[model samples]
Target: MFKKIAVPVLLAVSGVAAAAEGTTTTGVDLTPLTNSIDFSTVLVAIMAVAASLVTLYAGVAGVRWVLRTVKSA
Candidate 1:
């Protein structure tokens, strides 16, 4: 009898408490100075990744062009 009456009230209170105290961590806090990396190395890596992406895009475009031509012929 008491449990039936208290359960809903307790659930409602817990929900409100969780809403009030939402401890969400903002942004990624990776490594936190555990590993040291050179700025130039980072830049070079970024450049390499960008070049790879462009090369991939060109390859895909070339394949699409070849497929379209073959289909048309």
Candidate 2:
């Protein structure tokens, strides 16, 4: 049942794609827009620093808890 429905749908989609193959305009220049400043590196660095600080804080808290537990016992 699904095969019957899917075969016709696939053929229709291929026909439409073939019809649209040569309709695109190729006259636009996009080099300057694509060469703008890269901010992904800076964003990744900021995220790494933030994650390091959080890990450091968690480690310090865990050590302090262990020390307090030992002192009380």
Candidate with maximal TM-score? 2
lDDT of 2 by residue, 1-73 (tens): 9999999999999999998896777867888887897889999999999999999999999999999999999
Clashing pairs for predicted structure model 2, backbone only: none
Where does model 2 exceed 4 Å of error?
1-35
RMSD for each of the candidates: 6.9, 6.2
Q: Measured by TM-score, how close is model 1 to the native structure?
A: 0.49
Clashes of each: 0, 0
Cα lDDT tens digits for candidate 1, 1-73: 9999899999999999999798666856767564565588889999999999999999999999999999999
